[model samples]
Target: MVTSVLAGFAASAVLIVAIGAQNAFVLRQGLRREHVLAVVAICAVSDLVLILAGIGGLGAVVSARPGAVTAIRWIGAAFLVSYAIMAARRAARPSTLNPAERTPTTLGATLITCLALTYLNPHVYLDTVLLLGSIAQQHPHRWLFGIGAAAASLVWFAALGAGAHKLGPLLARPAAWRVLDGVIALVMLGVAVNLATG
Candidate 1:
């Protein structure tokens, strides 16, 4: 059971380590020092819900549905490609100004954006609830597996937000953002390719 839990944690880490909407938002909040705790809290809780939903037979049902996973694969692939292009463009012609400086900002707006970015993306559900959940189900201690997955999310989100916050000054530079954006583009492109052939 412990091994299963650890394996699930490792699997979750593998998938979540990649750059994506959630990671971007978390890093943004961290750099801004604007409700960074809220952002991580939301992300961790969301992951818990998603991981549980997937492990509790929801994944099997979804996967059993004809073309569901296929549809998600295509949508996720397209989003990843589109996001990669956007990131690369931003990196190439980097913006000196931060977006929060110009955009109308509010807690509600930020929270909604985070939720939309995390949940609205079918890829999230497919990856966490379906793919990872399916793997957990194969383990003897499925509940422990879910717990491990949830633990990974909690730990990762907290660590990421806190670490980025610590590097706030360094990350404030325009050049740093450009580099970050480049990394984001590469991560998205790599994930897209992996999904396409997986």
Candidate 2:
């Protein structure tokens, strides 16, 4: 059981630690200190649901539906491309990148974007639902493995969102924000391209 849990945690941490749209957004929210807790909760909860579904064998069902996967891929790519464009615009205009000067987004809007970024990314389904689910089935204590995976998701998101404040001073400058936004735009575009082409 211990080995199973550890395996699950390791697998999940490997996947979640990667820099992606969800992580980037969470970090930004953390830096701004706006709706940080809510964003982290939503991300963690969503991952839990996905991991559960995967462990419950929904991964097989999803895999059987190529058309559904294709549809999600295209939709996710489109959404990501649009978001990348917005980020690029922000990067171009450093004036709007200042957290102090920029107006805080409403909680409702922030949550909605968070959900979209979480769900619309087909990679989330692939990694959490299909890959993790398939891996969990290998353990005698599959449920324990699932629990461990969920725990990892919670820990990762919480740390990312909470720890972002440590870099607040570094990002206080407009130049730093522009660099950050530029990186975000590139990451989003790269992901979008991968989704569309892969």
- Model 2, 4-59: lDDT tens per residue? 88888989999999999999999999988999999999999999999999999999
lDDT of 1 by residue, 71-111 (tens): 66666667677777977897888577763353545788778
Task: Determine the backbone clash count of candidate 1.
Answer: 0
lDDT of each: 0.79, 0.93
Q: List the residue pairs that clash in candidate 2.
A: none
Every model's TM-score: 0.74, 0.97
Task: Judging by TM-score against the true structure, name the best candidate.
Answer: 2
Which residue pairs clash in candidate 1? none
TM-score of 2: 0.97
